[model samples]
Target: MNIPNLLSTMRLILSPTIIWLFLRDQTLMGYIIFGLAALTDILDGFIARKYNVRTKLGTVLDPLADKVLALSVLFTLAMKEIIPYWIPGILAVKEMIMVAGGLFLWNKGVVIPANIFGKVATASTYAAVLGSYVDRTIGLYGLILTVALSIVALFSYGRIFFKEKV
Candidate 1:
């Protein structure tokens, strides 16, 4: 596998480790692992773009890794009583919708690339989850922002997808 694909795989591998650490009440260690995983995400995208090594596998695995990591972190935080259930719950619904939409479009022989709204939503999710480890207030705000961004992303992607079908 290429460096980008490898980095994405590493992030996927790291997801459960971070979740386990958090579940064990070792948030500090979890945060470190989470940071490393985030770093790998950034590095993978950069390396993929810079080296022209983006593969179909990388395209699928990169976002899959991100979703797994983010969902695991959010679920862990919610389970630890660090955040409210609705935060992850809503995000989970949004993710499910996005996945279904993506699959629908894929079945139609269309590929919808990640847009800025989705990226902002993802970053907001990361901020929310990470901030919860430090301060609940910041986490709440971040979660709210993530929800808003996710809505916008959903709308944006839906519009783009439907428009392409015409």
Candidate 2:
């Protein structure tokens, strides 16, 4: 695997550890690990784009890692009563649809890259997750924004998929 792909793999590995830490009531440790995993997400994308070492595997793995990390953390936060269950519930549905759509496109040898909407939605998701640690109200607004943006991204991806599939 290339460096970017390796970093994505690291994020995938760290996600469950972050969830475990949260489950054990180690919020601070979980946040630190979450930050590291988020850093890997940024670094991998930057390195892949800058070095032009993008691969089919990296394309799939990068976003899959991001989705897994974000969804796992959101679910853990909801389980801890730090955030409402509906927030993760909506996100889970959105992500599931996205995953299904992505797989369909992948089967047809099409890989749609992340657009600006998706990037903002992901950043908003992380912010929302972190905000829940401060104030539930702040987190709620952030999550609302995240959900709206995620839906927009979902539609955008769907549009791209149909365009490419044709």
- Root-mean-square deviation of Cα positions for candidate 2 versus the true structure, in angstroms: 1.1
Report the error of model 1 at residue 15, Å: 1.0
User: What's model 2's lDDT at 31?
Assistant: 87
Report the error of model 2 at residue 68, Å: 0.5
Model 2 lDDT per residue over 47-148, tens place? 999999999999889999999999999988889988788988998998888888889888988888889889999889888877877788998899999999
Cα lDDT, all candidates: 0.85, 0.90
On a 0 to 100 scale, what is the lDDT of residue 32 in model 1? 89
Over 4 Å off, model 2? none
Model 2: per-residue Cα lDDT at residue 14: 97
Q: For candidate 1, lDDT tens digit of each residue in 29-60?
A: 99989988988888898998899998877877
Error of 1 at 18 (Å): 0.9
